[model samples]
Target: MNRSACLIFNPVAGQGDSEQDLAMIRAILEPEIDLDIQLTTEEISAEELAHEAVRRGVDTIIASGGDGTLSAVAAAVVSTDISLGIISRGTANAFATALGIPDTIDAACQVILQGVTRTVDAADCNGHRMVLLVGIGFEAEAVERADREAKNRFGVLAYILAGLQELRNLHSFDVEIETEDKIIKTSAVAVTVANAAPPSSVLAQGPGGIIVDDGLLDLTIVASLTRAGAIAAAFHLFQTASAGNGAERNDIGYLRAKQFKITTEPPQKIVVDGEILGTTPVEIRCIPAGLKIFVPSREEEEAVEKLEGLPNLTIEEKPSPENSPD
Candidate 1:
């Protein structure tokens, strides 16, 4: 029995040769599955194409682009039995990086052919379907600074440079956050609410790691800091995301909830899934097991783990890093 799939390819996603990527995807996937190729145009979006695929009753819908493309296609098929497949080919590729999906076209296509499926959490951010985190304040500012032209010129380094620049002007603002059980007030430079985030998305790694299938959103807030303190805090967060090493830092706040309503004193900017979506007084709600996706088998994951020899870092509090690293 062969699986029927629709491939929604974005030709202008990353700064790569779209022709070669498409050729590789078709060569690898078409042999194992009945593939329908859909080239996305400027007029018709990936989400629209995915809905069309759903109407045709394809067994799988595969998206070949960045996080935006994957999220759009996922939105069209959430809670349905149709398993979504990803062929990551975009700047950052953060969603794929978070899920342990290989970004290479060949490896991604092979994962789809393997036919293993995993169901994960998703979210609704002010009625927009969200498959990733929503960033407010510092992270949002950094995102804005890394404009399309800058990102195209410098790749991932653009984000790093923007983050460094934003650090200089970091300032705290008051926030009122409302959850189901409680209402809290605080002042912070940054706030992140995440359904899923890669390790490199340090701002969203509040509880050590973001569990995409956990049916809860991880919320992190960076408490008020001066220019120098903010730089140290940023380094601290990088440590947390990379090595799980920032637990003793009281300046950073962390929690988990099913929903959150966040309001800022000065009306902070918001970025969802890499797109700037204007100021915040935003609400986010988690949907449990809302997405089904193709992933590598457990055996494959274990094999990769053995090959990589990754360090096992747990969520234990390290010494307060106010002066630890600069």
Candidate 2:
């Protein structure tokens, strides 16, 4: 009951995620909003559809796909007044989950009707933009190796297989990370520059401990480890993620910064949200409250309560980590 809205959906997002229930979506939304539902085909992607909605002055644009689709729509709406909404149809609804939106389509529709709004942060790397996360090294490699066919068949388990395969071939990168104050050098297996928690599907990863609204990117650096070290480090990340709420200094290498730069001795792959977006020496900056999103009052309350305890920490380390990878 706030304003008119548009839903840009990809029918092929999940297993048998079809248009059969689209009429139901329309019916549910019509009473509360002036609804326009766009079912995406191969030629016109949901991102393109979102841009079209923006051009028409639609106040709220709902992305109804997975993390990739959500990232695309967020990119399209960046710096625009149009708000973003989510309808989770992907295998791992990371963006939606980070926003704390319920997973079911009908449940999501009801939340949208409730019409509560929250401002969330975002990050930009080179040309790629994402809300939940951007990463390099092992994690990016897992994304590159993640199988689409297998994901459709096995759902979230597909990423598990891909991650295991990448772990075997995992190579550490000589990373020189500099902010505005200090320069720290480490050979890391993986580094995540995050805004929200990681994508919804990657529930078991280190970023499950990240909070979206805190105005800082949670810089998670997995220091280079031998086979035993890797397993130990992986356990630590899992344990800390599982424990959740409040963080210990060394348990995770956590940093909060407004802007940051990261460089590697050699180039590395980058995954923004769940989409691959080139390599490093990427410059990252946090846009505090950059997006307005629709959520139910319960979700809004939950997000508020969740972020209340984190300390407001920002870093500007010296020898700024900004440049294209050499």
Candidate 3:
């Protein structure tokens, strides 16, 4: 492992004083990494701190907060060569889960010590660079509601509560999705533009959805009214999966593509990771392997094991400098 490093720590995250864990992490990493701790007080602090670390020639930048912090730091390293390390200390460590990085600080630090790095796809949501996935429609609204209370005593349950609340008032919106080869217009409740699979939510559980290295983004769109209706729609979707063809329900539209341009009648709120960004008329594209991230042993091992099972699988790495909209 390289000796030069930068640790961007969010003191406000986790159950209590993250500094206590930060101190312990520093102690563990001190022998192998040069730990420069930067405490984050605001959202913009992550990019500024990351840019500074890159300018100082730090070989690796450790994102020590939750998914939002990780996304911000990742945006700063879009075109840079520095590798990212994850310490999952936020309410929902989605990116951490997605990357197969351990939830424990000590376990993540150990992976850092091992010095394994893998390049993964990133997406440009309008101009903002995203590390995890982007949520649209009801999910975005859920994120906004969750954000209000998730900062306090609320945990992941806050998101669940907000989601159910959003579900109670759910209404499909008229929207158009423009892809390279098709234009689909539909009324949908929620849409997720994902760079990595299973999202951060499912990945925390050891095994999950699509491989991050697949070079394609997964767009999961839900176009339903009631909560039970949405659950039924998912089951219908799996039937199409077995046929190796995607299904577009009268209410639900789910598909995967590389680039998409979306326009809604009334601009819908967009959430990147957990933070809500601005609204629709957004252009999104996958920048293959735009950032190098640490993948935990389980994800890495699973990825290798799955590759052997695929008789028709294609793997490619895109190291080109990612371009974000102005």
Candidate 4:
């Protein structure tokens, strides 16, 4: 049976030639699927177009951009029967990298053509849908520093350079984290609430790794005060993330919950799915098995695993056909 798909593409994502990429995608998918391509004009237009695609009863809505574009499209299809596909053309491509989605144009189109789907968890922070992690304090600052110009010039290295700059002026602020079980009051330099993340997101690393389909959010807080302590903590987290293990450091706090309300003394900036979304006193809640996404088949997964160094860090169980969207 032929499936209908709408590709909502962001023209400005990454440093790609959008026309060439689009042509490549169309060439790969058009033979198997009825594909419609739409270019995104503004920030939230992808979400609008995704909703329109859903209304047209398309079988899949593919986001052809970075994490921000993907999140926007996912927001429109969450809890729906429409399967979301990804074509990573963003700087970090963090969510795509985490899910073993290939960044190459041909390989990504191949994943969509293969058509394997998996149901995963998503969350709501304030009113916005969250498919990746949210960063506060240091991470947020780093993101702010890694502006569009820097990203266009330096790619992923922009984030590192920005992060290093942020580290120089890092300062902890009072925070109150409220979950159903407990309330934590602490002074922290960084906090990460992740629904899904790759091993590269060291701040969200935990003992059990980050389980995207587990119906919970992995939260990590770095409470290091001094610059040296913060740097050390960051290194520890990177090591833990690389190993796909829980944090074993004293300064790092790790936990999991279905919902969280975080408030900072001096309101800190919040970055959700790579877009900085203003200051926080934010509330977030998980919606388990809320999103249906295209993933690699078992055979393909194995082949990719052999080539990749780090584990997905967010996947606990093998993705089964039973987990496909309704």
What CA RMSD would candidate 2 show? 12.9
Question: Between the candidate structures 2 and 3, which one is better when assessed by TM-score?
Answer: 2
Q: Write the per-residue lDDT of candidate 1 for residues 1-326, one digit (tens) a residue.
A: 77788999999888999999999888888777888899888899998999998888887899999777888898888867889999999889997888888998999999999999999999999888888899999999999999878878988889999999998878889999999999989999999999998988888776787888988999998885787777676678787777764434777888999999999999999998887888989999999999899999899877644324557754566878895887
* lDDT (CA) per prediction: 0.87, 0.75, 0.75, 0.88
Ranking by TM-score: 4, 1, 2, 3
lDDT of 3 by residue, 217-267 (tens): 777777777878865665665555545455646765556688888888778
Q: Which stretches of candidate 3 lie over 4 Å from their true place?
A: 42-44, 197-208, 231-250, 297-300, 303-326
Tell me the tens digit of each residue's lDDT in model 2 across 1-326. Answer: 34688888787888763766566677788877887778788899877887888889888898887778877888788778787777787887777777788878898888888877778887777766667778788888888888789898888888878887887887888888877787878788888887887443232245446666777777877764665666676666666576663333242465667767889978898888888878888888888777888777864455544444568955565664675355
For 217-260, candidate 4 gives per-residue lDDT tens digits of 98999999888988788888888777767777788998999999
Model 3 has a clash total of 1
TM-scores, each model vs. reference = 0.90, 0.85, 0.83, 0.90
Q: How many residue pairs clash (N, CA or C atoms closer than 3 angstroms) in each of the candidate models, in the order given?
A: 0, 13, 1, 3
